[model samples]
Target chain A: MAMIETFGLTKRFGSLTAVDDLTTRIDGEIFGLLGPNGSGKTTTVKMLTTLLTPTAGDAHICGYSVREHPRDVREHISYVPQDMAVDPKLTGRENVVFFGKLYGIPRPRDAAEEALARMGLLERADDLVRTYSGGMRRRLELAQALVHDPSVLFLDEPTIGLDVAGRRKIWEHIIGLKERGMTVFVTTHYMDEADHACDRVGIIDRGKVIVTETPGMLKASVCRDIVLIRSDDRFKGTFPEGVTFLGRTGNELRFEVEDGDEAVLVLSRLFAENGMDIRSVSVRKPTLDDVFLSLVGEQDEQTAFDLTRFRTMLRRR
Target chain B: MIRTLWYVERDLRRWLRGRINLLSALIMPAAWLIFVGMALPIRFTDNYLDFITPGILVLTMLGAALQGGSLLMFDKILGFLQKFLAMPSPRESILYGKILFITLRGMIQTTVILVFAIILGAQFLDPVLLAQIYLILFIFGILLSSITTTVALTLEDHDTYAAFNAMIAMPLFFTSSALMPYDQMPSWLAVLARLNPVSYAIDAIRDLQAGIFPAMTLAGLLIGAFVVLLISVIIFRRATV
Candidate 1:
């Protein structure tokens, strides 16, 4: 049986449908719900974690329904929110042990130490979290969530607002969790991270799931190869059998071909034969970003006001 | 029950670390005890400190209990509420934990003021009577903190919650029989004081100190606290993060 399943799950805030007809099944694998802001990613996580009640339908974790058996569902899952959750006034060890106690762990102190060590926060475990850096604090949050050894871990934008190194470190820990046979559910808008990190991804847009596929399959479905040529002149004739013209923007010419390497050779010779001076030529494999844009169109950067996020930003100062 | 205590331990642990928060919480009540209780010379009483000590103790609990709302407010504002609500423990644990912690902290702060009041020439009551005073203060703390924590659950931001604290804390204190006897006040002011929950507690403690058992007042305060707590619990169980 799948570890996580949602049956037509829906949540509405007044007239706004935050999550609409979101139905999917996730087995014990690293699953990514990829979407832009306000695309219902967080709302879905909240509902599945038993934080917010669904307006319609229901979800199950480890075969326990979130609506009917929320306590059992909560017992099998742990959630790390997008915001920083560590208590700055308490020591790192205290924060983890606090969660351990809440989970009713038999040995909270030992469990806290083990979780802290796994997150590489053991050395600083005695220091107050207020003294830790942003990255260290994020790691501490992970330790706190993992103290109970939950089977399915839900991370809502776990690496948001972190440096490149910090982001990579968090992903490494996440990958380690999957290796240990834990089903990990994560959400993010960084397409490149999802492309390489997630075993399967579901692209959600406007509170609906647009498509669910492996990253490779999603990219392959969009286009196998994209060939681009930066030229001083446009090709007057394109009598190619396999290559199809994509579009032209300024002095750049774009095309889709069955094979990138073969297209690179053929397109270069074709440009020379056409008497077009090619400034640059390159063959690129389609990325998840490309697939997302093709499926969901452009995303508007401006999102509605999130009061909790705003208050979090204010308190950080 | 243990899970609830864990929640209380979390807040208590944090509250203990912030020495400034601890010191600042006592400063206002201490000022009131010293400036108004000691310096004020009223013709109605020879020792105003004895009369005002019960009032100051309740005021101390009032301040601490009202400020208790901010404990939950900070957790909500700082994103801890999401982590906490998603836990396996019952949701009432969080609400009960905050109320318990606020009440416990109030007891500690009022203990300090009681000792200080005695040192400043206020006649100390018998041990049994002092214990009764603590009981009245405990009941009052529970009643006020439950309401404030529930209010915190409904408010969206900390500023609005702070505004609420300022708006209610002072009026609740002044309109009660904290500063003067109800008989000394005008007719309208006496009526409001008689109706205020704060006055029920203060009057009970004062009656206890005066060798009169205010059985009816004590029973009324207990029932009021239990009813308010029941309503707060019902509201809290329905609350979502």
Candidate 2:
């Protein structure tokens, strides 16, 4: 059964629709909402977390309606917001304990301690959050979210702005949550991270989900494997039956082939028979970045301008 | 209700850790009491300290309430309020917790000011009258805290909130009977003082000090507190996001 489901979930700020008819289902697994800045990812997370009421439609968590039963939905889920929500003046243990109390747990102290231990923050749990590093603060936020043992967890850009090592640590813990049967729904801008961490990735652009599929399937659906053939002469002749010419840059000719390895062998033989000497041949698989770019298009000047304007509005607010 | 208490407890712990703020809260009222009591003439009572203690107490409560609203503003800016909004607990719990914490801080400041007033030769009332004074301060604390909370939730930035606080705080204090008797003021000023809720509280406290029960003033304070609290809750629910 789907633990988190949304149907036509929409939010509007005056005339601008932040989330437009968003419909999706996330089961008991790691699902990622992938988008760039100003793509409505955070707005959708806010709606699901019950921080903002949708202008239209509804969402459900663990069979509870978000609009009709927000409290019940909150009981079954926990949210780690994009911004740092932990109090810097309080200790890590105190932060988690306070969250536990807000959740009305039976034993807030034990729950806080256990959560800190899970995040490997037990030793420094007594220290003020101001004394902790950025990575530690992010881990503490996760610990606070998990103290109540929520079945589903929503993370908005969980590892954003973190160093590579810090990002890896957070990813390891998130993957561990999946292993423990927690339904994890996260939004992120890093395509590579989503490819590796999420069981399924939904590519959202301009407040609409463009595609939803496994990482490999998403890549495959956009463009096939590419076989790069570098030769002294530009190959402008007809291609093989299974190989289609993609593009050429300088002395290299690129072709989209069903099987890159087989195409390389066939293309090399064809080049030699055609009296053309090949300099180098390489087969490359398409990455999620390629898929994302193809689907969302390159970041144009208008999109960049929109993002800056959006950030300014947010800051003013 | 337990959840609300938990928030109050957390806030109290944080407030206690902020020793500098606590010290300042205590010192400001005492400074006002000493300066105003010594500088101002005493016409209504035999001792200036005795005449102005209730007014200073109300001033302390107002400052504490403003601080509470500032704290809420910080919580909103820092995203702590988002955490509370997203939680499973009732939304009213957050407002109640903040109000209770502000009232408790006001009460503590009131006590410290009362101690200083006594040391400075202010008259003491009977036990019953003292209890009534505390009750009046409590009601005033609630009223001011609610108003501040509503303003903080309504304004978007701290600079605007600070401006609004400054715009309202001094006028409310100066126009009230905090520094003088209501009858001693000009007719127009006396009318404004009569309309101010702080005037009612200070008047009630002064009446209680003179062994006169202020039934109407107490009832007015209660109704005013209730009305402002309802408005704060409504604004809080709408403005949290």
Candidate 3:
């Protein structure tokens, strides 16, 4: 059974379609929503979390429709919104206990302490949250969500504002939640973060899921095998006819072609014929972002971003 | 229930522990008691403290009500209400916690005022009458808090709440019999007092202090309070997004 499902879940803020005709299911260990800001990521999570009602369509959280069974849907779900959710006045432990009570858990104090320990906040449990750093509060937010042992956890930008190490620690805790049998539905801005954390990712834009697949499958679909070619900042100079230039980063040239399976052999022959010493070569599959951009027409591109202004062009019913 | 109680307890600790909020809460009320009482030359029928004791006790609730909208604003700003809403319990638990805290604080403040009054030589009415007075005060506290909670839930900022205070509370305290005896006021003012919820609260409290049972006054006070609470709940449910 699908742990979470949304059928045409639509939300409109005035004329802007924040989430439009979004149908998705999270049955995997971890599911992700990858998109740029104002791409309806937060709006989707807010709707699923019951913070806002859908303008149209419906969502089923743990088989309970968000529109009709909000309480039941909420019963099986835990949500950690992108914003600062912990109270500044309360201690880290106190915040956990309060949320635990909300989650209908037994022995809230102990549950709070255990969650705090899991989130690596045991040392700062007694300290007020206002005294903690940003990363610490984010961890506490995650801890509170897990206090009730919810089956499905919705994390919106779990590590968006964190430093590198903080983001790493959060990822470890996220993996920990999955190991404990919880289905994780998360959204993030960083392409690499989604590629790493999500077992399967769905790239969302203009309130719709452009594509959904395992990171590997997504990369494999675009670049069947990986061919690492070294070129200096020129797309036109590519020697291979079938090889299509994806882009360039510094001195490295990236490509997506029909023959990704025999990438190494094809690259060696090309380099050998040219009598050139390769600076550095990498034959790896495409990243999810590559497939994401392919399907969604480059979600991060300025042209795609400028489409947000069209939100105001919408007329009210 | 415990979750809601925990929030109520947390808010109470924060309010009582924070030096600035506490100091202002205490000093402002004490200053008003001294400044207004002294400036107006109002005295108790028997002892000055006795006559003003009920007013001062209710004043704590009034003062607290003025700032009550602040918690909702803080919840909205801090994003703590998100956690509370995500919890499986009825959402009313959030509002319930705030109301419970206000109710408890009202009693505690009244108790403190009575203690301080006694120390300063204010005698109690009959012990039985004291219970009636406290009951009247409790009902009034609920009404005052319900109205304030609705405003806080509806208003987006502390500035709006402050504006509401200026627009409503100032005029309310001025027109009510909080500072003067209703019987001694002008006829037009007396008519306003008879209809004012604050006046019913004050009248009910003063009547208890005056050693009168005043069954009808208690009934009127309760009905007024019930109406306010009903309106508050309706406003709260409607105002939230």
Clashing pairs in 3: A225-A260, B44-B48
Q: What tens digits encode model 1's per-residue C-alpha lDDT throughout B1-241?
A: 9988998898888888899998887677788899999888798898899999889999899989888877887787678888988899988888889999999999989988888888898866579988888888888889889988888877767889899999998898999999999889999999999988888888998898889988898888788889988988887766654
Which should have the higher DockQ, number 1 or number 3? 1
Steric clashes per prediction: 0, 0, 2
Question: lDDT for model 3, on a 0 to 1 scale?
Answer: 0.75
Residues A196-260 of candidate 1 have per-residue lDDT tens digits of 89999999988999999999999999977989889978678864888989899999988989888
> Model 3, A101-168: lDDT tens per residue?
76777788999988899899999899988899888989998888888878899998889778999998
lDDT of 2 at B225: 93
Per-residue CA lDDT of model 2 for B1-241, tens digit only, reads 9988988888888888888987888899889988998787666767778888889999889889987887777777887887788888998889988888899889999998888888888876467877889999998899889888778877768999899888988998999998878677999999999998778889899898888999988898899999999988887876755
Residue A277's lDDT in candidate 1 = 92
Q: RMSD in angstroms, candidate 3?
A: 4.6
Q: How far is candidate 1 from the true structure (C-alpha RMSD, Å)?
A: 3.8
Residue A75, model 2: Cα distance from true site in angstroms: 0.5
True contacts kept of each: 0.79, 0.66, 0.57
Off by over 4 Å in 2: A229-248, A259-283, A299-317, B41-45
